[model samples]
Target: MKYDGGAQNVLSEDYYNLVIDQSGNKTAQGVINVANDMTISNSASFLTSTNTIDVSEQQRWRNLNW
Candidate 1:
């Protein structure tokens, strides 16, 4: 998914798995927090490229039930 120029996408701490296959410029003009077990596979064309992310906070959180 493309994190447009002004949108801050937050994947909050939850009990699940997230898998994403994206292409083009996945630029996070704002914060983009990808939680645990998130498998992000970019396209072959953008495979050698890196995403620009602005992390406002930590990506992972401790499970209280554990």
Candidate 2:
């Protein structure tokens, strides 16, 4: 999954499991309470992309995951 724009794009959500693999799959490390928006790319299994999702993470609304 990637955004249609470049730096103009932003991470709108921060509380869901995502897939970061070769087969384009969805991963899960359980539910984690996100305090702020951030890019979490790890090998332990956890999260996507767009306009090349290489973009940074940023939150917009609040308590959307709660």
Candidate 3:
């Protein structure tokens, strides 16, 4: 918090943006959003020489509730 009160409470992240103007105006934007969907991700890469390349990918998911 600083003495200058031009704009307060501002936050910006990788996929989202937020701003609060001096007149109590708020602006928000998000590039990515996921709602009511199960999210999963997997990736694979090769780590062999130019002559030989080996790539493998596997995924395992487990959900437990009590």
Candidate 4:
């Protein structure tokens, strides 16, 4: 999902299993959590001088052949 706004947006830890695709201009207050099954595709940038990219990679295999 794409979060576009003028103010700073905060990404919660509740969305640990969600697929988030970032686009447009956005400002965040803290780090963004990347889930094991989640993928963040940043087509555009919303980074500032103070902002940082701190994403965690949780590697796990899913049974796609089921």
Using TM-score as the measure, which candidate wins? 4
The models' CA-based lDDT, in order, is: 0.33, 0.30, 0.21, 0.44
Candidate 1 regions exceeding 4 Å error are 1-20, 42-66
lDDT of 3: 0.21
Ranking by TM-score: 4, 1, 2, 3
- Tens-place lDDT per residue, model 2, 20-50, is 3222224332333344442323222224232
Best by lDDT: 4
Q: Write down the worst ten-residue block by lDDT for model 1.
A: 44-53
Residue 3 deviation, candidate 3, in Å?
16
lDDT of 1 by residue, 29-60 (tens): 33334444434454411121243332234443
- List candidate 3 stretches off by more than 4 Å: 1-12, 15-21, 31-66
Give the TM-score of each candidate: 0.29, 0.21, 0.15, 0.37
Query: Which residue pairs clash within candidate 1?
Result: none
What would you estimate as the lDDT of candidate 2?
Answer: 0.30
RMSD of each: 10.5, 13.0, 18.9, 7.6
- Give the residue spans of candidate 2 off by over 4 A: 1-23, 38-66
